[model samples]
Target chain A: MFLNLFLLLAAVLCAFQAIRARQMLAAALWLACTSAIVAWLLYALGAQEVAVIELSVGAGLVTILFVFGITIAGEEIQEVGSLVPWAVAGGIALALIGLVAWFVLPAQEASTAVSEPSFSVMVWENRGLDMLVQIGLIFAGVLGILGILAEKETAEEQARASQKTPTSTPPLPQPQVITTDAHQDTPIKEAHA
Target chain B: MSSELTITAVTVLCLLGVALYGLLIVRNLFQVIIALQILVKGALIALVLAGKISGQINLGQSLAVTVIVADTIVAVVGLALAVQVKRYTGSLDVKNLSTLRR
Candidate 1:
């Protein structure tokens, strides 16, 4: 019981930090902590598969992504303060969620029965295609990001190459100053004068 | 009423609530991500707890695993996007990201 409470408190604290932390990196860390706690709770509750998934994906991979994002874009996260109204809004939202959960979740989940927890079934069942689609979504996201990050000059080069209309604006000839003996003699005469 | 179960469930729920609250309140992208992770964990725990309460074994576990996989992919993509956005915008603040049209 004490352990559960401790975990719960840790989860809450981490969650609060994630939400209220000014630094994106900090938030990501807090989120990872939260994920870890959840995984632990799952294990404690006898849901080993869930715990593994949460630990591997949520706590490990997702957190890494957040950190990577922070490192790649900007290392600093700015603080914005507007508390009263936000708090009020949040309170209302929480109340609504609580009400909904109280009324709905139990009833909906009551039908869950004891079935063999087969990994293959979970992976390749009707929902297997969903995973593939999700992967496709990630691929599209990567492509889109790459497209956005491509330098303007490369894009221009591509355009020029594709157009195949080479304009004959001859590259400017290298500057040449021919110095004849006559010119040297004049400079010498001027120096003497 | 198993005191252990009750205490664990309530505590976990509270923590999850706190994390969700943080996610909603924090302004930093990193913090938001952190809070999101916490919220996800909380939800996973809640599912597991529900399973325990009902004496069901793996249903909740399967869902938790799915969430984990989804979170991983999402994080990878999110990080990639963050890096690209930083390179493009020179800042990580979510407020600065106005170029995303959708």
Candidate 2:
């Protein structure tokens, strides 16, 4: 119990930094730390399968992707103080969540000690379909992103090729769009067209 | 010492609230994604905990795996789009982007 509390406290500290950090990279780092802690939390809770997934994808892959995003969308680090209102509000919300969680999660789960099944059984028998879908979804994402990037590359090539001088220096990391999420759920659309 | 389930669930809720707060007020697009990641993690925690509570551990594992997969896909695509936006405007402020069309 003390261990869990420690880990959760560490996560809370990370979350606070994630929200309060001045640099985007710092925030991303804090988030990564939080993800890693959560993975450990899962393992302690006897969900080794989910823990591994969370560790690899959430802590590993997602952090890399976040760094990639931050790098691609480079921005000057601005001073982050004067956001006290945000901090206060976050604190209250966190407290409220703590209370809700205490009430919502049953005490029985603490004592419900079931022996764990083999990992292979879980994967082969019950979750084979989910695994297959996961594989397919990953491939689709790769193909879609490749297509989008290739399209962008060719466009750049044409633009650069048309100009008398090869000046492709305008690819600074300005996050100039609000529609990142809608198409994220459907990278396959790019693959189709 | 609180039960493992209570500690885990409390952590999950803490994460959710922190991420929600970030989503509501933080504007750095990458940070927003981080917030979203936390939210997904919360779902994952709940899945694992629910399974433990009900003795359906495999089912919970399956669902958590699915969520992880979907979350990864979303992260990849989201970053790619963010890259596209960066290439287009040469800025990552999210405030600069207002329209879908050029």
Candidate 3:
């Protein structure tokens, strides 16, 4: 009971910091901490597989990606001061919604019928297609991200080539593709501009 | 007072509300992303609680795994897009990009 309360308190505090911290980098770190705590909460609640994945991907990989975002963009935008107004307004609004939901939502009852199925049946037979589709979705998402990043890199290379190859003086053949995207459109551009 | 009453689920849902408020009001891309992550966490907690109550732990685990996968995918693609946006616009501020047409 005390552990659950402690987890709840930790989660709330971290969530606030994650949302309201002035520096994006700081916010990202706070978010990582929040993810770690949530994973712990899941573990305590007996959702071991969920907790492990949350620990690794949510806390681990996402945090790394967020740090990369900060480094790449590297523009520091300070947080707006004073959480009072936002907090009060948000809390009140949420409370009102919850009040409404409590009455409107149907009461759920725990199933009294306990038919024990083996873990293998639950996983392989019942959930095979579900897992298969999820794997495919994640795989496709990864490929999409890679393709997007690659496109940006090639665009940068083309822009550089355009810069180096001068026209008229040497009469080098006109480059085929136009300005890869825009000199002004990317993070590297921020450095030069 | 009943053990069957899901007070914990309510608490988790309240946390989701807090995260949702942040998501709605915040313009900072990173903060919004954090808010979104919190929201996902809240949902995962609620799912676990529901499964526990319904005596369907395996079903809940399976659903939680799906949510985790979806959350990861969104986190990745969303951050990448945010980076791409920053690259083109030279600012991380979401309001700065006003174009409706591609």
Candidate 4:
């Protein structure tokens, strides 16, 4: 009972934070949290395989990707936009949420009949192709990173520019000094005396 | 209430939810990543709990292994992005990243 309450509270908290946050990064975080909670709920519902995928792909990889994209693309806000659009969007979303909740409430609590192999075996062994596709997706991501880090003609251009620049001042010439004996100067001084 | 696994599963879900919320609401990229980590952990917990309830060792082990891989993938990607952000903007705050904004 307590755990259930905690889950409920966490879900509520994540939703509230996601809705109220103004920053894009913050919104992304809240979204990740929401997905995580849903993943856990899925597990509790006995869909362990689905839960793992949800957590890994949705919460972990997706969140990082989102942050990466946001950072790469820049998430800065130049101005505070009007709230009119926000209100409309919120209203529509809330209405849809209410409708879905009402529709699913009856079946939401209904326990699924536990199968022999369960959903786990089905996703893993039966859907190996999907897993292969997922691996490909990861490989694509790595390639994308490599593409970003690849240095192009920019470095060469910089080097050429430095080579072409002229020197501001000529190098200082070395000073030449003739060595004179101190004893010779003393003899001249004595003759003068 | 019914079983330890069930209770744990529910708790994990709630934690995941909270982490997601944090990820969405926080403006700081670091905070978002942290929230994402929490969310991932919650999901892992849920998977493990389900494995326990079902009495299937193979499913649980495989699921755990996959989750770990996913975790590593996310961490690597997230670190790379974080470094890139720092390199470009000199700050991790998303609000400061308006160079590409139209």
Clashes within 3 Å, all models in order: 11, 9, 3, 20
Encode model 3's per-residue lDDT on A40-83: one tens digit a residue: 88787777877888899988999998998888878567455433
Q: Which digits, one per residue and each the tens of the lDDT, describe model 1 over residues A83-114?
A: 33677757855775586457534433334556
DockQ of each: 0.44, 0.43, 0.47, 0.12
Over the stretch B26-99, how does candidate 2's per-residue lDDT look in tens digits?
65556667778878887788888888787777778878888988988888887788778777866555565675
lDDT (10s digit) by residue, model 1, range B1-102: 377666665655565566556655554555555555555665667666666666564555555556665655555555666565565566656766786554
What TM-score do all the candidates reach, one by one? 0.70, 0.77, 0.79, 0.46
Top TM-score prediction, candidate number:
3
- Predicted model with the maximum lDDT: 2
- Model 4: share of native contacts present? 0.03
Question: lDDT: which is higher, 2 or 4?
Answer: 2
**Better model by lDDT: candidate 1 vs candidate 2:** 2
Per residue, candidate 4 scores C-alpha lDDT tens digits across A95-123 of 54456435422322214434445455645
Docking class of 3: acceptable
- Residue-wise C-alpha lDDT for candidate 2, range A143-188, written one tens digit per residue: 9899889989998898887785646675445443344577476433
Off by over 4 Å in 2: A78-103, A106-117, A165-193
Calculate each model's fnat, 2 decimals.
0.55, 0.61, 0.41, 0.03
Q: Compared with the true structure, what per-residue lDDT tens digits does model 4 show for residues B36-62?
A: 656666655555555555564346545
